[model samples]
Target: MIRMIVKDLRINPLRTGLTALSMFIGIVALIAGVLVGTLGRDYLEAVNARLSGRTPTYSAIIDVTSVAGMQTTMTLQERLAHFEPGSASAQYHLNDLAIWASSGDGGLEIRHVAVTVTDAERTRVMPAPIIEGAWLTAADKPATLETVVNENARQYVHDGTITLARTGNPQQVPARVNGVIVDGADEPVIYVNAAALQRYWPQAWTPDGLTILVHPDAGVDDRHAKTALDDLLADVGAGSVSSWNRSDNADEYEQVIDFLQLGVIVTAMLLLAVSAIGMINIGLAGIEQRSHELLIRRALGATRASIAAQVIGSSVLLSLIIALAAVLISASLVWMVPWMMPADSPLEPPAYPYTAAMIAAGASVATSLIGSLAPAIKAIRLQPALALR
Candidate 1:
């Protein structure tokens, strides 16, 4: 049976090959669409994760430099002192404003920054997607006056040492420029440990800046949290608080991607419909051309089941070849994404969409079976006695 099917296809190579090519085109299109859709969604999710810290947390900055705001800042600091990490409402960080001038090759660079001071370990409030160097850690507390600078201030550090001058003193203070945070913010920010700050200016170190963190599953709604915070600060006469909330941009992106996927799916279905029609026409023509030969086989005692099997098997074989070719081509394109992307691009190439490819392969097989069904049925119903004429 296999030998007969091969011979039949080989006899009309042009027609068989053209049918396979049509199926291949449709299968490839479907696979490509799925892969691109998955990649687009993954990229958007990555961006959101980076920007929002992937957690339900709020960082509120309060101004406490004014005489009126000082009492509020101190009261908030006292309250935060009792709060512990991993609690429902945790105080992530507390810092005070510190201004210093650093001498570098490009003259003196004056930095207006808020510095984090705590016995507890404090992490980056808003970490950048791309960090050039290491962040300040709890272990770095032993190193006196080590500071992490923003991307803009990185130029002033020569040989890891930057000479900083305090406002009141004539003497220059040299501090180690540990790392950089490139969050695209214009503020020249610096985060230093409290122990380190006290070592240089013991009396000036105070908690003026605060960051409140909440667990994603903490069950605390943003409105309630904001209102409670407002009352707490108002009671102590603290200045108005500025908050950073997670943007709904990611949700918008997901909706857009869903629409794109739907579009791709519709387009792919249309292409497959065209391909299926072409295959069906080719199958009918082939069957009609070989009607006389098939009748001779039936006269030689070929059962109707055998004849139907032969027709269906030929379509399946053609489809299998088309599916394999389509999968290989789609995988090759997905693999090339990373190489084609820019070096600093935030998006990493997505993995091969195996699930999508398998679905596409199944669709290809079904298309072939459906397209050949009518011709196979017609061939099976033919009577040898009448066709012998």
Candidate 2:
């Protein structure tokens, strides 16, 4: 039956080739749309993660105006002092202080840079792509405080030392620039170790805001983690303490991606439908042209089911070949995405989306089956007596 189907397809090469070509185009479009949508969504997710930290990250603002606020802030600091690593409340905390510092290269001009005083765990909570050097570590703490600067700061700052001093204090300290990172910040920013900053200039170590990130392996949900964090800082005598989760901001971006993917799927489906229509038309015409041949097969003891199988099998085989080719092309395109992106972009291209390829293959097979139905039915209905006529 397979040999007979192959022979019949080869007899009308132009018609078969045209039908296969149309279906092939549709499969390629479907695969491309899925690949683009999946990759685009992943890129957005990575950008969001870099800017706002990973999901479930909670940020709290401590109000320091009132007397109670001052006491609460002091209490929070006291609690942080006794923090033990690997405890039940093993949450990672990050704090930042905005300070004015002068560079030897800048001479008389002092630059305002945000100094993020955090531990090595900062990367696990809020990941920033390292551009030149490495992230902060315990070993980075020395007499000359090692700091990582963002891309904006690297414009004026080199891999050397910068002077840090309070606005009115005559005392100055030197901080070494160890590396550069992309933190998605518009202004100049520097990251330093909390212990090093506190040792050199305790006054400049005061945090303007606090960010608490719950560890994924901490075995606690967001609600419980937020409650634990609030309880930990409850001693802050501030007028009001407000907190928000990163997921709140991430939802908006996710909705936009969902809409885009929906549109792509719909468009791809339309293209497949058009291709299916072309296949159905060509299949029916081919059956009509080979009516006498089918009648001869019927006379040679071929059952209706066998004749129908031959027609449908030809379409399924052609579509399977097209689907495989389309998947290979789409995979190659996905692999080349990183090379196409700008060097400054922090978004890392994700791996090829195998789910999209599977979907495309399924759609191809279903479309072929649907398109071949009419031709299969027509082929089976032809009487054996027609061969004698």
Candidate 3:
């Protein structure tokens, strides 16, 4: 039966090819739809991953004001415990100072280094990518003054230390560089435990802001979390605090992804439906043109069942060919597309979904079968003697 169907398709190559091409187009549309849906979700996942690398989980850095009367570690802890239940907290200060760096010419080069005084949450939430050594932990300080410097600070750090000295005051503190981190900055930056920095340089240090790590499924989202934090700060006369707005952005991003998915699916469905209708038309025309041949076979003792099967089998063969072509085209295009994209583009090229290809193939064959059913039945019901005339 398969050999006979193959022979028939081979005999009318042009007609068969054109009908298969229609289904092939539908398969392409289906593949594209799957890519669009998959890519949308993949894009979101990539964005979330990038953001997660930069930002800490359930963490927010808030602005503190003088009206808050210099937030102390003890005070912030009490406020967090009272309002934001089931949450963790930390404090950080972003400061800057001019440090004397070795210029490699044996001359001193003045480099401006950004300093951050952070609690354990610094490592927890916004953990920088560690390139060398280990990250700073709560236990890292008190025993020795340790600092994690960014890659930009490598030049200034000699003998595992850097000198911090102002113009008039010759007093210098040589901080031991514990680790090197990738902070995505062009300038030298250093992170140290807040208590250690303040304890050493009482006059140079000041509390800047607070960081809070919210827990997962903690019965609180960003808005509610922010509101709770704000209310707590306000009650303590902290005025207003600034946050990264991660929650708001995440919600908006998800909505956009959903919209893209819906559009792709609807468009693909329409294209597939049109293709199915076209295949049915082609099937009916083929049956009519081959009526004489079919009747001759029937008169030679072929059963109605065999005649119907032959017609349906031919449709299935055409669809299989179409599916093969679609797979080749889609795979090639998907593979080569990333090379054509710009280097710094935001959307990462998506991995081709093999499962989606199978679905497309299945849908195309099913449509082909349905399209050929009526034509097959019509051919079966025809009077063999009359058709043979």
The CA-based lDDT of model 2 is what? 0.69
lDDT of 1 at 335: 86
Write candidate 2's Cα lDDT for 145-243 as tens digits.
667888888764633765665555566667777788887888887777655565556666555544444433345565565555556655444323465
Comparison by lDDT, 1 against 3, better one: 3
lDDT (CA) per prediction: 0.64, 0.69, 0.69
Among the numbered candidates, top TM-score falls to 2
Model 1, runs deviating above 4 Å: 55-131, 139-207, 213-249, 288-303, 328-343, 381-389
TM-score of each: 0.65, 0.77, 0.60
Q: lDDT, candidate 2, residue 363?
A: 86
The TM-score that candidate 1 achieves is: 0.65
In candidate 3, stretches whose alpha carbon ends up further than 4 angstroms from where it belongs are 44-204, 213-248, 335-349
Each model's backbone clash number? 0, 5, 2
Q: Output the lDDT of residue 201, model 1.
A: 48
